[model samples]
Target: MDEERPPVVLVPRGGAWGEAVAAAARQRGLDPVVVPLIADAPPEDPAALDAALARLAAGHEDSAEDADEDGVPDGRHGAPPTGRTRPDAAGPGAPWLVVTSATAVRVVAGRVPRLPAGVRVACVGAATARAARQAGWPVDLVPDDESAAGVAAALPSDAGPVLFPRSEIAATTLVDGLRARGIAVSEVVAYRTVGTGDEPVVLAPPPDAVLVTSGSVAQQVVRRMTPLDPRTHVACIGPSTADAARAAGLPVHVVARSRSAEALLDAVVETLHPNPRTGRSS
Candidate 1:
């Protein structure tokens, strides 16, 4: 008898990777099981975030500021103030907003109550885009790159100077790219990402493939699941993620073109299907 399809496991900790994986598996007639290994929450340190928001609102920087140097905020200030404190008045909607993460969406919404109706929004992935929509901002663009560079490339030509509230560890590529295109951009630290929990999650026999998107997620995975199953392959969502996976001592079987779950699934399918036309493996 022909063998049954092996169960495919989705390990999206939060946001939308798990759902994307499940959707892809279903499209391919594969049985998918969602096994969340981690989750995301607001930063535990409120005081730190409060301070960061204050700095962003005031446009005050102790050190010389550049977009590239903008990393995850330590949030030493208080919560984002309501009205006029926001940089530049775009007539209740002057600035276009570009956010790359789900957390950033929450930060922008909580801090800026009047997000200016004319301020359009753009993000890196479906999850971030969805988060923006939920925050009552109209999403203008969703990048195909999934990286900072991708988001930068996907920006609409008419998007005005953009306000980016993201992690302290965020890449400067987006900021630099936007600046090169003559788009004014602000890099604000909405929150900081520190390793929160620790405890290796051991699987029964290792999954067929493990998908990793962020450096922190990779670090956590390594710290938690170090003695990885020899048989399981690792698939990174993009170049950055692959770099992290390699650093963690895991061989990356595939690297998705963009940092999206759809790309990851495509990578997996290509790896598994090989070349049916050639009657040989890829």
Candidate 2:
């Protein structure tokens, strides 16, 4: 009798995020099959984004000023940047910068190495938080709840102003939630999420589970691959992704408690590991 293979998981992501997910799956004793279904592109029109960043860098007549006594930039290095290294980022008048995705982090950091002085930073989830740290930025806030409502509820009610750099098609939950709380929000499109069309979701070796990272991924998974195996569990990263999966007509088997990779895997392990499969080859 041959040894049975471990359960397999299909991850619809590429690049570093995909690699990380694969590693996580391996550690969890599952086989990870990666398929790059989506890609990122710069926004078609960057005028609004440029203007907002320009304003953020304004009032900084002296760019030679050093970082604060603690060595953190005005916007703070432990979070997100406004772009170029401007000490004013830590200044009292700075806005609180909010980054919801890793792509947004890369876009903003490329322009404003440091956010205009005095700007604080908030990340939506652990993955995004890691990206912020990788950019050499300071992080002041990371909500316990990774959802927009969670972020809004966790933010300081008295937060003066917030600078939100997000994807072109990003949902307005965060903006709406913050505005409803009486906080001023400046929203800008940082990038566009595009379809890769790399390969139309072919499952050579049928997976026991599929991990959906975002609403876009959910849509793509359903569009490219449908009539999934009844035994295949579709795990969504969070409530929003789960909703998207269901709306796209894909049955959602599990929903992670939060929007992080760890949470997603936790749901997978708890749901699928009880009874492992034996070589689910399509």
Candidate 3:
């Protein structure tokens, strides 16, 4: 009899990626186990964020408006009254979203009473767009090249004043690139990524494959790989994540497209099945 096949393992580095991995695993007929390496929490100081939220709520939080009123570009403004809220379309018009993570979508949905119906959502990856869509908002652009830089470059010229509400620790490369390209952005810190700081989960041994999502996840996986098998296959979402995995000295067997669950599953199928053209074809 053939040896029992080793189970494919999934490590959803964080809550946002967990949602994607879980959905993708179900689609591919695999059982995914979530080893949450990190927790997403609010900022360390709630007072500053609370004050900002109050300003945005009070109708005077427009970055552009503040800039115009001050003549000087960068001085801080006094916080607006508490419990103030802005209209959904506060900017020039309905803005297109520039979302990089699923958490960003949920954060915005939670804070904004109701999203602007006419606003368009643009996501770096399919999973992020899916989350926004599930929340009943219109997702207009899901770029094939999934990254902050990619989405920034792919944005339509007509998309006025793009809104990017993302994690405080997220890379600023995308924002810088968009700004260099002359895209007006009103960015807000919607959430923060916190290291769980929990003792690493003990593993019996690494399975046949390990799925990795973000840089933080890669680092967490490396830290927790003490009981891991040396021969485990490593799969990463994209070039950035693949780089992280390589930095951990693991042989990366998969480099998924666009850092989405669909792409990761496709990469896994291709790795295990080995048909370049049609991964599942025997």
Return the top candidate by TM-score: 2
- Candidate 3 lDDT over 12-116, as tens digits, reads 564555776676765564446677776678756646544444543443234444433422213233333223222333223224567888887777777665654
Which 10 consecutive residues of model 3 have the lowest summed lDDT?
Answer: 70-79
Q: Using lDDT, give the best candidate's number.
A: 2
Write the residue-wise lDDT of candidate 2 on 17-108 in tens digits: 89998999877777899887788888887888887777555523222243456433354322333333333334332457788988889999
lDDT of 3: 0.63
Q: At residue 177, what lDDT does model 3 achieve?
A: 76
Summed over model 2, clashes come to: 32
Q: Residue 13 error for model 3, in Å?
A: 4.9
lDDT string, candidate 1, 98-184, tens digits: 788877888767867645544556788876787778877777678776777888877744343467777777768889998887666
Residue-pair clashes per candidate, as listed? 14, 32, 3
- Give the Cα error of residue 154 in candidate 2, in Å: 2.3
lDDT of each: 0.62, 0.76, 0.63
